[model samples]
Target: MKIYSLSKIAIVLSVLLIFILLGALWRVSAVPQTSLIVQDEQFFEVKPGANMTSVLRELAEKEVIEPSFWQSVWIKSNPKLANIQQGWYQLSIGMTLLNFVQKLHVGHVVEHKITLVEGFTVWQWLEQMAATGDIIIDVSYDHDAFEYQFTPLSKHHQMTIREGYFAPDTYAYAHQAKASDILFAAYAKQRQQLKALMSEFTLPKFIHNEHELLTLASIVEKETGTAKERPIIAGVFLSRLAKNMRLQTDPTIIYGIGPSFNGDITYADLRAKTPYNTYRINGLTPTPIANPSLASIKAVLAPEQTDALYFVARGDGTHEFSKTLAAHNKAVKKYQLTKP
Candidate 1:
């Protein structure tokens, strides 16, 4: 009778031990099964000072994971919950709980999606670049500094970073990246693209060097923002360049006046005697007014074969291209007239 009692007790204890082992194994298996969560295509920012519960709540709020209670329970049960790592994580939609935990434990942060669009002036880009956190491009870094450093390169037969010379692309970058490095990368990409396109073009007698072409492309980019108008604008500038006439691009005047120049181009701003003022310079500015798109670059390389020598904005994000001064004057009067 005593032996029988002993056997029953042993069996009960054995079953309890098995259950405990299974629970431990289950937790271990779950550590790697967390799914990635993405909300509205934005990565969650797991900043500093976020605790395990707060992180879970943030995940829940972002719709990357389920309700807070579930995550809270899971995190509490996990042995490695003390190692809640923080950074900008690129969580996907429908991420599992375990994978999410692992990501935090590993401290994986998503890079910033820095999109430098075409037609942004250097000063405008500098402001946007500064807005991103931990970026080191000081607003105090003078434009003259960049120009002075690059002028020597131009003398060495190398192209400098000028308007329309940087590639317009969405680049993935760390938050800690330097501003100068970002600008340099964009310029390098532009050079690579230019080299490939330059091989394709058989230029005429008038267009001699790469700088002249890039200068013309920058003017085309500034004259019209619409893609459809780029080619026609390029023709007008190319024609003007051929005739030794002033490009008279308004963007150049804005560039001359610096960041103080608002979008409004005043008559006095046009008459400004700065080197960047196309009205005064009678040709392309020493630097580009803004970063031109690839379409503008290609337009300069393969300009539309036309006799257009003038263009004026229609205030509708398009341009009126003309072959004669009379025709251009008529367009200006029709489009530039103010409605009281």
Candidate 2:
């Protein structure tokens, strides 16, 4: 009878112990494990091959997650949690521990952004990419990779890195994003943008194909500052092209001179026989001088119909368009020669 009584007591104690453990797990799981107050956002990286234990320890050390023995127990209970992906992660306030672990396991990481501005040269674009602190710029990678990657965009197989094929816009990427990834994104976006724009407008008589249209658009972009003036300036270039007149645009001369070009263009520079020198070469430059915006590209396809062939800057970030050389010379004297 004493033995029976002892067995009953032992059974009751075992049941009570199981209930106590279940209550503890429920309490820990419901309580907030982190009190991170994300203002803008929080960024962190998990190195390749980082295991869950080390990762959780680092997160606790950083105060991203509250350190708790129960939390470790919960995480270790699942064998699938072992496959944590390595990359940057953006964490925010009010995220549950369960949600965070799931995101890490699936490799959902934070994305970084870099903006490539309109009218930026290829070199300028590279500099912008390097300026973004998040990306890993591959110094040894050849910049000419664009040639093979975007062969159809080039007029010939000899397309150099200087060709303005990359579309100018803001781009987002994950951490450790390479320079090629950014460039290729820009290029791909530009191709899509150009293709869409092409379908919307009939190709102007002067623009024979996509390559020529982009070349003209780049010139129009460099020549004008005002967005409203793009179509008008495109008209002047088209008119010049129609009449077989020398483009006489100074930007082309500056482009030909390349890095050696000082702030100013000289008379000798105009006469210099470079492929990009519009004064020496009759048609468009061998390639685009800078990446043209979508608006500029659109303007080239649908130019403002006008007989005006000349424009002089009005010094107030505008230009005075004229129909004849005589009128052009007069405007140049007023705007250029009489500048204070």
Candidate 3:
């Protein structure tokens, strides 16, 4: 070899580096176009315990991509990216082969959404959760199962059943995610939120702990149609609890009736005595009738200073609050009865 000066050697090396960069660009650009790769399926599932080599082979077998020997060599060179994550990967209509590979490399798996709505019972949530596809549920949904899932939370509060323990919100999870994990997440979130609320506000005798707070908040959640009305509704329930008046919230009776409720609340249902029928029971329900939102929970802690002891629906998904039964009955007559 001929001896070269440092400047000339640097120039030669720079030229070779440019050529290598171009080759690397070509390596990726030469792959398949940005198509969904979903000729017959919408998702590509990478089974658990699969390695990068096996995943590449599966992709090649499907004709999604055929990594040439050089490309394979390049992949092997990146040892950090040698393992593929496990989950179902969604292939959009405009996804490219490189985009798909990047998703597989980074564990950007397909995400499924589930909503735990406020004022809906745990049983309803389980029904919705269990009905979802690709969401794993290893255990049955029963009293014992719910108790087991809520044991961590029940250490402090009496959650004999996993009722108002779950925080109401929309959650996203990858395919093969456990439903129980989501359940615990919701529970843990509620615990954190309740703790925060308790720390923020001083509790009254009527509201003893997180369990009682959620119990009253669930009633408040069901009582109001408008979000702004939560504080007022919460105020009415708290006032009633303070004065030894029965809660008499219709939602409690509906919950007590369970699946037999036919979208109508009759006098008989109000008269029926159950642990949840606040019209018949004293003070708060033994447990939450349904999952309440944080707003409802906060509404209980920092209730609107009002003497309103009752509220009636205003026919337009609003409420008319009153300090006395006379005003409440008038509101009921105007809104609940026919437009006279």
lDDT against the true structure, per candidate, is 0.70, 0.79, 0.75
TM-score of each: 0.66, 0.76, 0.76
Model 3 spans with C-alpha error above 4 angstroms:
1-37, 57-81, 93-97, 130-132, 137-161
Q: Pick by lDDT: which candidate is best? A: 2
TM-score of 3: 0.76
Q: Sort the candidates on lDDT, descending order.
A: 2, 3, 1
- The candidate 2 region of ten consecutive residues with least summed lDDT is 141-150
What would the per-residue lDDT of candidate 2 be over residues 277-313, giving only the tens digit for each residue?
8988898987887889988998888889998999999
- Candidate 1 has a TM-score of 0.66
lDDT of 1 by residue, 287-323 (tens): 6667778888888777777888887788778788888
Candidate 1 wrong stretches, greater than 4 Å = 1-109, 134-141, 144-163
Candidate 2 accuracy as TM-score = 0.76
Q: What lDDT is reached at residue 76 by model 2?
A: 60
Candidates 1 and 2, the one with greater lDDT: 2
